[model samples]
Target: MSVGLTQPIWMEMALALLILPGVWCTSWLVLYQDVCAVRGSSVVILCTYHYPETLVNKNLTVEKVMWSHGRKQFFDGPFIIDSNNRTHTATKFEYVGNKVHNCTLQIHQVEQSDSGEYAFRFETNNGGKWTGSNGAKVNISELIISMTTPKVHGPIKEGDCVNLTCMNNCSSAVMWFRNGKPLQEESSTLYLCDISFQDSGNYSCSPKHHNRPLSEVIRVSVEYSPRNTSVSVWPSSEVLEGSDVTLTCSSNANPTLNYTWFKIDGDSCLEMVSQAELQFNVTHTGNSGKYFCVVSNKHGRQNSTILSLKVKDHAEGMAAVTLTILLAVLAVVPMIVIVPMVTWHLVAHRKKTTAPKPDTEENTQTTEVHVTSPTSDCSLTEERREEEPSQQDEVPYATVHITKQRANIQQQNEEATAIYSSIWEQQAKEDLYSVVSRPTPRGKQAQDDPVIYSTVFRQ
Candidate 1:
């Protein structure tokens, strides 16, 4: 029974050797499913392979090792590298492995065309062949540049700073370009300091020392506040009354601006409107004053120069002209009505003074003559002559001697009455022409004396 057990154990050990070789061959060659690499960089593909231990014992050595692109049968696709023959090896690829089952591959200066599925094949001296059907795939990508902010779109203000970075699968020297010109920077990160309006342009980045694809273009815009603010007025600064006025504000700025119009009050500014231009109709002198405008944006604000306005009062000017004309008419009308009346009174007084007087007797009886009233007419009557004169020689004569005193007294009374009447008529004319009449003083009128005249004559 012991001998029979020993035979069965020997048969089982032989069977285990054959089965282990088959299992190892089937589950050998191990590597990652995919690999990512950047253009103009280097990459190392990690791999762990296996082979049957029975092959090593039988002295079956690896004769050839090859790597190829695409998924096809062994030795069917274009070969990328051959370890056995140095002449057939690719310059970019190298196999750094020992006699063990480690078959790692390294690629230098990777390019876009090198991206594809890659497989490994190995052949032994004992007519043994194996190929890793599940191989690592290479996916090549270009250098990517991005902003380290919340939003990628850039419109930064002047004097501000921004951060930029270059991204890739592997570490490499990166170059920056602005407006299609090299910036001479060799790092993964770039910082733009004290940006200005002139710095606005297209930007791109790529890896150095290789024909690497460039990143997408990034547009950068620079903004600034308003400058050189000014104001303009339509028509003119000094305008007539009842005219339309317009004021416009302008400035230089990057972003759009908001405008506000203000009028200068006594000691402060009063807001009038919120727009680029202010327009209103002027009606009177109240519309004339000082004004200004302000322009603002996200960056800063600016104030325009102050302006003044003038308006003429049309109604006041017309009223002044009318008053002058009325005064002139009043002065002329009084002269036209009073001059003719005064001239007529003077002519009548002259006629009364020059009229002929009746011839008086040279001698008359010496008798006292008296006139009681000033209005009674005085006449000389001829006395009856003693002897009747012939009809042919009709003459009436008086042989009586007249005293000079009586005749002189009678003539003086009549002259005095005429002068008094002329004086009273002149006083009445003066009262009619007086502009403002005033009552006489009570004491002054009582102090003056009254004069009376009487006329007496004998015939």
Candidate 2:
């Protein structure tokens, strides 16, 4: 099988030639060529040559070397530089390389007139005369940038518009740059509008071809008037009397600025240097009021908003500081006090929730009952009980709880009903007295202590 190539042989050779630097070579001669030269700069054309050591048994040797250019015939042209005579057409053309296979030539401060082809020649001891074919060729070019100048030829002021143009300024657009950084604009002529101070910088444009040089750098400057006028106070407003305080006024402006302070007294204006921006001190309440500053330049002037200046005596200042501290402490006191209380409550509640439940206590009741003979002092029952509540509860204070055991009256015969009716009639006239036995304290039994109490008998 035959291997195939992805590209043609000529295409591959052309790519290889592009990858290599400028060269002009023959069988016995070699020259290092410069693709182009920039005007006003130095350029070199490197060269080297060799011959067969033995040409027909007669050794070939070089005797003289010469360089020439600008005539119709390459070899017949007058030699600009000659090694044998040490002759040179101009000081700008120099022979830097030696005769030993090194024949470098350098031109200083190249000019447009230097744009031409240069060739080299040599004569050997064996009658060998040769000139390198089509020697180093040089092309000279220059970069230029231009812009429209305002009628007032000073620096461009803020908010001014301008048009910057490159040489040739072809119909098709090209890349534009500012301060070496590329801009989004693409035009041979770049447009700048509403320029600001930040827009001041160097600008240039790209060339049409990669081999061509970029345009020279051109600087653009923008000047601006005063803006963002403001006033600042040091040591704060509301300062104590006899305390040093400073007031400063500032603004953004160009061509320098002058600061002036003013006091707005009714309709009149008082001029002072508190606007000294860049100072005023207060001592008494007389210095307190609405004040302003004026920042100005030849371009224009701007004023700051009213600044309230307050000065107080030592007593008032101390009172204010003390009040602030007191309020701050008061505000924090509630949190400090409530935190422990809330923590205690939270601990109690959590213990209540997570701890074992406590057993409930049962209530005990004691009742003492006695008969008052159903006769004696029935009417005086309430009078005695009202005067003896403590005596009734000397050993134990407990309410008497009675559960009524009622008889079914509907089931009673006529005889039993008659007897109940007679007793209820007598009981309704007065309440019956009971003799209550007060209980002793814990571990002691009661010896029937008489505690008089009242009970109502109801039918």
Candidate 3:
């Protein structure tokens, strides 16, 4: 225990040795992990280290680092170092380094050609050699390029300008390609400048900087047909009186196309339907025919199929013809029905009108004879009266008028005279017809006629 007071420095050094690891850990390694950048952007790679203790006390140093282009090969032969101390030169590569400990490699203005594997070798304490695993890979990219061209999807008509346009994708540059060649001004921008129908064809754009492939091609077509291309008559389908036969045009046209119309007058293809649209207001048989549309554009002209529009029903004349026919028919049908009925009625009426009324005088004379001749001697007297009768008495003086209109008059007279007769009044103008009138004697004067004769005339 007294000996312990005399401490030993050797013990302290032993304790320090036991607590620490044998070496300082410094070795070439990839410190910062991999990274990514846009096609035209920049990128960087980092390296770190842990050195052994035996090398730290000694004049140990990281001499140099190197990269190899192994794009075509999986493994590469050793290449030159990028360090200032190392002696190497190459046309394909140039490298710069950082200070001794940092040991960084910088490639200037990196391009797609710089994408490849890299490796590092170092000279250490006592000149020991150390090499790392396969080096990190660097990648470069091209700028984005997207281009478009308009392609008309409809049919082509005369006089269309065929306008076209080219567009680049968002955040991209547009370059127009025509006939497999890029224009100098067009290629400068990643976009289309101007376009037209003449620009119609396959088009594409090359990616900028990095070795990206060209975009797919697009085709543009510009074309338009005339709108509402219709042929019409000047006076419409119906021709009217006192109007000029003029044809006019009404349609939408591109490129200011001209129009012509034709007419099929008889067998000849005359230009009756000219003036764009045929106008035959004072239209006659000559103005009717087949019509055609002739449309001309800046590029060329086209003819439409023939349209036969016969000028017929005019606004004024149309109604008149129809009305006349209707009037004629209306007039004729009633006559057809009424004429026969009226004729039959008239014939029957005329027969009735001319027929004698019941011979009331003869009846009275006979009745008077019958009554007065209640004695057989009066019969001889009545016989004498009959023989003495006049020529007028031979035929009936009481005629009956049996016209339909005067039937009531005939009915009233029949009750008083025991006889019937009628007469019809004329309508107007010339007398249309006439009927007979009969007279009736009524009251005791009829009964007291001395000439009256009564005889039982049996059926």
Give RMSD to native, each candidate.
37.8, 18.1, 27.4
The lDDT-based order of candidates, best leading, equals 1, 2, 3
Full-model lDDT for every candidate: 0.65, 0.65, 0.45
Question: Which one is best on lDDT?
Answer: 1
- Model 2, residue 142: C-alpha shift (Å): 5.2
The TM-score, computed over Cα atoms with residue i paired to residue i, of candidate 3 is: 0.28
Clashes of 3: 40
Separately for all candidates shown, the number of backbone clashes (residues 3 or more apart, or on different chains) is 4, 2, 40
Q: Tens digits of per-residue lDDT for model 3 on 95-129?
A: 54443534345554555566666544454434444
- Backbone clashes in model 1, listed as residue pairs: 369-456, 370-456, 371-455, 371-456
Question: Model 3: how far is 240 from its true place, Å?
Answer: 62
Tens digits of per-residue lDDT for model 2, 251-294: 88876788888888989998876336525457678988877899
List candidate 3 segments past 4 Å from native. 1-28, 32-56, 69-77, 80-87, 106-116, 140-459
